[model samples]
Target chain A: MTSGLDVRGITHRYGKKTALNDIGFSLDKGLFCALLGPNGAGKSTLFSILTRLFVPDAGEVMVDGHSLAREPGKALARIGVVFQQPTLDLDLTVRRNLKYFAALHGLAGKDADRRIETSLEQVNMAERAAEKVRALNGGHRRRMEIARALLHGPAVLLLDEPTVGLDAETRSSITGHVHNLASEQGLTVLWATHLVDEVRGSDHLVVLHRGKIHANGNAAEIAGDVSLQTRFLEMTGGGK
Target chain B: MKAALICLVAIVHREALRFVSQRGRFLAAIVRPLVWLIVFAAGFRAALGLSIQPPYQTYITYEIYIVPGLCGMIQLFSGMQSSLSLVYDREMGSMRLLLTSPIPRWWLLFCKLFASTAISIFQVYTFLAIAALTGIGFSPAGYLAILPALIVNGLMLGALGLLLSSTIRQLENFAGVMNFVIFPMFFLSTALYPLWKMAEASTILRDICAFNPFSHGVELIRFALYGQVDWMALLWVLLAFAIFLSGSLWGYDPSRSMVRRKA
Candidate 1:
């Protein structure tokens, strides 16, 4: 069976400055992968490439076995993305936003409505679907965005810093919801973050620093006796 | 084909909702031109008496003369407003959502242009309706005829806006650039006066106005409002649309985007 995501030789540069260098990784179906990195560790750049917002200088991104370079539409259809920055139209209702996204993926009529309800239910935001995005607090807005991203039933879900700026309680809830999505819905997940606490011992982790992966394994196995936070700091050379 | 249609309708519906939600924008789109019509045009009525132009078979009032220009103004502003929203969308990250859709980028951008143009048409008719109620009336058939003309002109200006929005680096720079564009395009064209009147001022200015693609858009609407067809004007507008569309498509090319360069 084809891997959920197969990235190979992903290298990108901004003029003379290299942002990502020959980075490669693969995530299997239903596995949750944490792309752990610091603020300037090229996490966002990699997410941009994965989302096809920016084409990497050299790389191959395959979503469900469809090559992004050759079949961008097909590849994109297989992967749902939530950007680090909020993407909801603030003036639109939560349901309106989801419906619009569903239509973009060619879902409509009762099918779109059904998926909208299901995804919102998954995020536990079904009751707030009629509220305008601006009326919702930041946490609810983030939940609505996540719900919108899942309406198409993508094989892979890519989120770039989805928990930024949220309160601790909200952040943990969103993280828990996504983790449950991977296990319960059998969805592939690649979540990029600078927050180490968000990673679980059982989850696969790829530590990235200065455009290169420093470690890749089960979080618990790699960290061993130390906490994942301390291990991440040590791997990135920021340890005390 | 079905997917394309669904995408178009969804985008158009979103644009419509945005337009309605922003009542201030609707008010401004109308008031800017109405001020020119009721105040500026009223003041200039005696100063600039229009003679028998091709589009105007007899001596016409200045209000009548500037109606097409006002329609063009509505579309032009609406187009630029659409451009402003796009820049905002890019900053706020909603543009990424739109860009990541499985539908092709070119088609999506075209849908955006279509949606804005569709909204501009509604605003133009609303202005015309107000004018009609305020003792400035035209042929009802002429009103129907101007629909296609307004669309062609709308597409031209909206395409120009798309090109500018894609190329512009920041939202702060957009307002000044819009002023530079809107005032020049409005003043230097045959929008307020006939080209012959421009020729009366200076040969150089006349030539400049003659070369302005916006002049052709105004003239196309002017002729259409009179139930006449100006093939030259129509051709010029279409050509401008083609050039601007191509330029915008290139400007929005992912490889050429500012984010890629800044990264």
Candidate 2:
């Protein structure tokens, strides 16, 4: 089967500064990958380009054979995005927020209702559908956004720093849940973060530093004979 | 097309509902204009000394002449209020949700202008009704006649807000845009006083008011309130609307990657 995401020879710049250079990667179906990077590593820039929030200066992004520039709507329909910041309308109810997303993805009527309920059930937020987003804790709010992202049944999920401000237990639980979704549901995942603990041995890891990919390999293999943290710092040129 | 329309409605509905939920906003919309109408206009009635414009057949009080200007004020402030909230929405991240939708960016920004115009028209009618209750009245035919004119002016001001929202960068800088936009647009326009009145003050000030698009907005309202169409002023408002709307679309282009840095 074809890969879920194909990014080739991607280069992006901001004025005189290069945010991403010669970045290329691909993910097959059902793979969970972490975009591990340090600050100023161009992770957000890549996400902006990938999500169609910004256009890259050069290169291409293909999702399930749909090119972003040629057919952005169709390509976007196949992918889901969760921004690092919470984007929910605090004044709106959780279900209302999810329904708003459903409409954006072109799901309506009975099909939309079913998907909304199912997606909320998956993220453990079904019961709080009536509550406004302001009432939910940070972890639950993030989970709500995750459920909203999945309402369209996207083939690939792109989460940018999903666990930025959560407690340890909640963070791990959310990570485990998304990992399970990728493994069991044949969902491809690209999770961006600065945290090292979120990466696992079996998962694919792309070490991004200063807008360039330093290393890309299986986590256990790349960090072999050393702590993943140490290997990461050393690769990014952050060694003491 | 269906998906795009739905996305537009969802974003527009979110704003409309927010306006409905804020009781203070509704009252503030009415009261702010009423204060100028009752307190300020009453005091300036004699000193302003208006001639009979097309809308005024004979010697008219400053309160009566300023009604169209006050209506223009309602649209102007509502436009700026919409702009202020756009800034707030960007800071809070909700604007990002609207921006990242896969539809063409111009369509989305236009949707915002259209929505803001609807809300502004609603407020103008309400202020008109309250004005009538207080013995400040318009010709009923004049009232019906001004509806389309109000919409045109509303879109012009809202497009301006959307444009300013794109370039202002941060909420901190929003005040600067307001100062540069709001004060000049109001003081230089016929909103508080007429162009002829400004001519008495200074020829430079009169020329500035004569050229202001907002002066045309007030003229459109004034003529409409007298049950006559001001096609010349209508053309100016439409032209301003097109320019501001186009500028906003260009400013927020994804190719610029403006939001990534602005946010």
DockQ for each numbered candidate: 0.75, 0.61
After superposition, the stretches of candidate 1 with alpha carbons farther than 4 Å from their true spots are none
lDDT of 2 by residue, A110-185 (tens): 8888998999999888899999999999999999989988888888999999999899999999999999989999
Predicted candidate 1 versus true structure: per-residue lDDT over A1-240, tens digit per residue: 999999899999987889999999999999999999988899988988898887889989999999998899999998889888998888778889898999888788999999998988887888988988889999998888888888888999999999999999999999999999999988999999999999999999999899998998898998999898888888888832
lDDT of 2 by residue, B1-263 (tens): 88777877876787788899898998998998899999999889866777777867898888888888888888888898898898887778777676666666677778888889999999999999999999999778989999999999999999899888877767788678668988899889888777777888899999999889999999999998888888889999899988998888887887873575624
- Compared with the true structure, what per-residue lDDT tens digits does model 1 show for residues B1-263? 88889999999999999999899999999988899999999999989877886977788899999999999999989998899888888888888898899989899999999999999999999999999988988999999999999999999999999988887767898878668998899899998989899999999999989999899999999899889999999999999999999999987777667557652
Clash pairs of candidate 1? none
Cα deviation of A103 in candidate 2 (Å)? 2.5
Relative to the true structure, how large is the alpha-carbon lDDT of every model?
Answer: 0.90, 0.86
Off by over 4 Å in 2: B260-263
- By TM-score, the best candidate is 1
User: By DockQ thresholds, what CAPRI class is model 1?
Assistant: medium
